[model samples]
Target: MEIATPMATDDRARFETLLSRHRGIVLKIAASYAWHAEDRADLTQDIATQLWRAFPGYDPSRPFPTWMYRIALNVAIGHVRRHAPHSRLTVPFDEALHDTADDLTNDRDGLDRMRLLQRFISDQQPLDRALLLLYLEERSSREMSEVLGIGESNVTTKINRLKQRLRDYAAAAGHD
Candidate 1:
């Protein structure tokens, strides 16, 4: 067995702290990719596991969210791809929209809008869904490129195309 160094212990502590601070990022990615509660939980756990395994390789100079998003998106996309053949992409919009009692009580219209948006996103391809998630999170094109391993110009082009697609979908659905 290998001995644990003091540095390893410190690193572990730091990783836990960062993970706790940014847990919502993992949850949002999981929720965006997973349609069922059980699947969301599994994706969340998988993301955490992957993050822990990858923590040692994280470069401190880069933004934490950037690195975290890359890992989370990769895991989420992989999970979706693996289960796509057997799974339906139907998200329980009402249940997912009202995540808390406060949300349930307030912002009914906003929740409805979010539910519709979620449905639109769920109908998209895996990469398009990922792009939408990153865009909704307000990540910069450069950041999206870094997380997605694509060129910044490609990220910009995709975002424009995605916006047009969403607009077209809304128009066709009579929500325009």
Candidate 2:
């Protein structure tokens, strides 16, 4: 009684590939938002789900990782929107649907401040997260505007504001 199940296999392979490449960054981003240890896996799952959901929407002309990053950040924030920010989130995992939110969050050291940075990062809209990631990666504002569908001036203004936001977080956290 052999069955021909192609879709499941394809989805699993796609998930494994994307997870292998982006899990670290996704984990980092999730841990930043979640304030507990138990939540990391949950949040990671959220990111994975979001990626899978957004996979079909991916554009070939655009860079894969950048597009993936957009999906990742968007899913993370969407999780927060659905679940309370401080509590551990538990959403049904679907390699197909994507996005449930993070469960990990613990910043025990100065290095942990990166999580807080993610908090600030995820605070913005998906487009803003993409913009900031590009800015941090040193992508030019013109390029960011193109990717984000905004004017370059808007990119500059947003960067200035985001930087200030990060600085404010650092100041409050005593990291700066």
Candidate 3:
């Protein structure tokens, strides 16, 4: 076993603080990729471990959330790819639907819409799913480009295409 130095202890404290502050990002990505609760937990752990390993190299000048998102998304994409044949993609939205609406009919409508949106997201390839998640989070095009390692123009184009696809899906589902 290795003894911790002062520098190492400081780094550990910093890492824990950062991770705690942005824990939701990890959980969101894991939920989007992992259909089962156990799988989500495992993916969250995997992401945290990878983040810790990469912490020493993290640039203090840049935004921490963006860096965290990049690592978390990569891990989630990898998890989905590795389990592709055995699992389906899912995201948790039940609470969102149940908590927002006051009327039963409105709740039903929200649930239907949520399910449609979820299906569209689940049907996407992992990279596209990541793009959609970033887009939904209101991340700027440049930031999305940085996280996805794509050009800003490409990010805009993909967002347009995704919007069109969602429209088409809604139309086909009689929600247009």
Which numbered prediction scores highest in TM-score against the true structure? 3
TM-score of 1: 0.90
Q: Model 3: per-residue lDDT, tens digit, 1-176?
A: 99999999999999999999999899788878887778888999999999999999999999999999999999999888788888575565454435644543456777688778877887888888999999989999999999999999999999999999999999999988
Q: By TM-score, how accurate is candidate 2?
A: 0.57
Worst 10 residues of 2 by lDDT: 92-101
Q: Per-residue lDDT for 53-98 in model 1, tens only? A: 9998999999999999999999988998898899764354556666
**Residue 60 displacement in candidate 1 (angstroms):** 0.4
Prediction 1 global C-alpha lDDT: 0.85
Clash totals in order: 0, 12, 0
Estimate, for each residue in 79-129, the C-alpha lDDT of model 2 and write its tens digit: 666666555443222211113223333335533564566556656654666
Stretches off by above 4 angstroms in model 3 are 90-107
Best by the lDDT measure: 3
Which 10 consecutive residues of model 3 have the lowest summed lDDT? 96-105
lDDT of all predictions, in order shown? 0.85, 0.63, 0.87
Stretches of candidate 2 above 4 Å error? 1-15, 85-134, 139-151, 164-176
